[model samples]
Target chain A: MSEGKGGGETVELLLPATPERLALARTTGAAIASRWRFTYDEIADLRLAIDELCLTLIRPAQQEGEPRRLTLAYTLDGSSMVVRGQVDKPNPAAVNGDGQAPQPTSVSDLSERILDALVDEHGSERTDSQLSAWLRKGRSVAAP
Target chain B: MEEVFEIAEYSDDSTPVLSVRGEIDVSTAPELRDRLLGVAQDGYSTVVVDLSEVTFLDSTALGVLVSGLKRFRSAGGDLRLVVTGRNVTKVLEITGLVEVFPIFDSVSEAVST
Candidate 1:
């Protein structure tokens, strides 16, 4: 249908759960956000926020042994814009792309806490009858 | 879609408070490192990192804090952890970082000592 744009056009970008893909994610996300003419701050937020999306999906989804697919979909229009993220996992995802859920490494105390917190914040949870956890993790931005 | 990153409010005073929120990562770590260092460098003897609002953190980010803690302590300042939830504590305990930094129940307690 009509999403404020002229015709039927949707943008989709995919990135792996690796640090190497972070730059790409930010670049692509910002580009999409810019299409709607978002402000610099808005675009920056989208960049960092989308980075979290990858961390959430990658670490929690445990794609290390294999490869987890982080898919982002954004629809832009003259009036509004939308971004969506998706991943496959059960309870809080995994850590560092490893399907094996590892406790924090024995290093720094704050580091450990940070690792666990990242998991809960990024992991996908199945709702009553729908897969809505991933999308919920994404933050929206509006151009001005 | 809404953004997913968390931003912590950091304060550097006689008693520094690193108010953290959301998740911390390599991408957004400089902000945190600067805050932590700023307090420690300002000669604050007590640095309290409030993780009550911090829902998530990572190794690289944690390393940033660890180094900050060491630097703060080296400068005669002490870095204290304000535990917020079991999830974060679990990581600390599992990682055995609990032995390194002083852990407090709250920011008030962290600053008190």
Candidate 2:
């Protein structure tokens, strides 16, 4: 856990959606999770979900033929660390199939698993809040 | 932040025992995948990755493991991993890759058998 100033006890980092950057997010998340006292299992789940989200976001970027970014942010909350990120790809699972967008099968399945696991861990409301945060300000990860 | 990463090395014809240190996450997974791919390309018969030092794992790393194992196994080679951490072990168990790849408790034991 990296030490911070005062009692604010908040840590944040921004990473792109590339594989290399995704890897950094996982490593950074793990470190922050440890700093915030997340259980081993909690830390593992958070990392897996992060990878899945980033990959899913990648699929959309490929579809739009534009550069889409995955941004992850975090902070030390109370007991569990909150990870928030945007999969800049228009929710692959909800694609309209309007002949304008294509969704990758493996990646979506992987993304679903990631979302499902996170939902199980923190519940739908928390998941929604996390996603909302991402939509509002790139992405945020909070741990306490 | 401090980074924990290392290459798990081995040679062909010899039972490869890879020593993995630090957390196997999205960022560092490619390095691991490449290392395992090298072993497969070298035509090794058995590769045992030592993960006792690993403290964390994610699905991306899990995918790398899955594909790497398949690549070697398809060529009549094999990839086994030895992991002994609660979190790491649980990831394998949850992902159900433990059954896909032969698992062991230690490097010495993984190599002996």
Candidate 3:
């Protein structure tokens, strides 16, 4: 556990960059959201967002042919939770089904659409080496 | 923790129905994709996926559903969904897939429509 910029509680997890571990991430997110008294819908959004975040990274780590661990930083406070992560880009040759360099522009666009609809705020940055994304969800008024 | 994923097949008034319960995430989406596509390829003109009991659904699961929907529509068939719980509905709403697929309150309604 770490401290957020404003002294909020931050829970960080480092898990194998494998699809099997995605379930752990989802459950952990749900538990955190529940403990923070988020609504059912808010909790579901957190779980789904975490899933997308992990899925985006798993392929790239596998394509690298190296053991990789995904780091997830969740900053929680009374107002919101901000989730952040970074993932390496997969080898183009390994991901292409048609034997050409894989084009993932559309996938990135889809991810944006999903995060936008699910969270209060979201964005991602892509570089030659890795992709980093962040999403924030505001606490529901119904929360205790 | 054990992964809670199960897909069962049954016929509702001759319409093929896939009842999916538990989490549908990266690890389980492939199995769902296979079963749904199998049902469509088996010559069924209409397929209904019952997600009322599903505890969780992620982007991988959504992608699988989208692919299945395209397959069914191209073959002159359709994929309908029975979505009730907040877990499944929130994901669909976020992905804007609720508008893309025909949604029903129950398997009976999905099969009928």
Instruction: Give interface RMSD for all predictions.
Output: 7.5, 3.2, 2.0
Q: Which candidate's lDDT is highest?
A: 3
In candidate 1, how many Å is residue B9 off? 4.4
Number of clashing residue pairs, candidate 3? 0
- Per-residue lDDT tens digits of candidate 1, residues B1-113? 32255545555445657777755666566678888767655677667888877654545566777887788778776778888675566556655678888988987777777
Which has the better DockQ: candidate 1, or candidate 2? 2
Residue A23 CA error for candidate 3 (Å)? Answer: 1.4
The lDDT-based order of candidates, best leading, equals 3, 2, 1
lDDT of 3 by residue, A64-115 (tens): 6677667788888658988887655545444444322222554444556677
Output the lDDT of residue B62, model 2.
76
For model 3, how does the per-residue alpha-carbon lDDT over B1-113 read when each residue is reduced to its tens digit? 85668999999899999999888877888999989878876888679999998987776677788888888899898999999997777767766778999999999888887
Runs off by more than 4 Å, candidate 3: A62-66, A88-109, A126-130, A141-144
TM-score of chain B of each: 0.84, 0.90, 0.95
DockQ of each: 0.10, 0.27, 0.52
Measured by TM-score, the strongest candidate is 3
